[model samples]
Target: MKIKEGFVLHSVGDENVVVAIGKMTKKFRGMIRLNSTGAFIFRQLEKETDEKGIIDALIAEYGIDEQTATTAATTFVSQLKDAGVLDI
Candidate 1:
């Protein structure tokens, strides 16, 4: 349920654009591409440990209902898993 140890985040010229890096590679594989909202969720997951904490943080930060936030966070995490970016 968390990003793997060797991955890092970087910006591409503009601060708004973000990319992911995996260890042992000079060029990122570009397995996952995230928009600003997805990036926010990704950063939050980096700081938080579990699904509940992530859902709570998103709810507090975005002022959204628990169900809505949970749904979005769950979907995002699933996408990361499918992309091989997460170790959970």
Candidate 2:
């Protein structure tokens, strides 16, 4: 899954955030929110272009076991799906 276009990322304090910018005459605003972990996973998905690659990257970056990383990535993916932000 990948983040949809028209979305911009920002850092709010210690958390990484995703804000959807409205198009045309609509006012710019955030349409979805994600926590730091979710943002990290989203960023990986944006780069890797596949689930397996995302899992591998997560393991390498976080030093977590494969199972743990897979579970976390799955959950984060679900959240993005539910929010209509995923392009899978």
Candidate 3:
């Protein structure tokens, strides 16, 4: 899966916020704030990828266990899916 087009991530203060632009503005008007972990996962989703790839990246970057990383990544991806911003 990958992030839908026109959704960009911006660094703001200590957080990363995602904003909609172009045609995406019609469906999603507000930005979504993400924590450090969410920001990392979002970056990975910038291109075509899979659940294992994302989970692996999270584990390598944060030194977290596979189970924990999978859970967090799953939850965040679900949020993007709910917001209609991911090409699942």
- The model with the greatest lDDT is 3
Q: Is candidate 1 or candidate 3 better by lDDT?
A: 3
Ranking by TM-score: 3, 2, 1
lDDT of 2 by residue, 1-88 (tens): 5777766677877767777665611543554566767777877766537777778888898899999988988877888777767778
Tens-digit lDDT string for candidate 1 (2-85): 776656666555443334545524544544557766877788766536778778888888899999988988898888777666
User: Top TM-score: which candidate number?
Assistant: 3
C-alpha lDDT (0 to 100) for residue 37 of candidate 3: 89
Error of 1 at 82 (Å): 0.6
The lDDT-based order of candidates, best leading, equals: 3, 2, 1
**Tens-digit per-residue lDDT, 18-51, candidate 3:** 9999988988888899988889999999999988
Give model 2's TM-score versus the native structure.
0.80
Which 10 residues in a row give candidate 3 its minimum summed lDDT?
A: 23-32
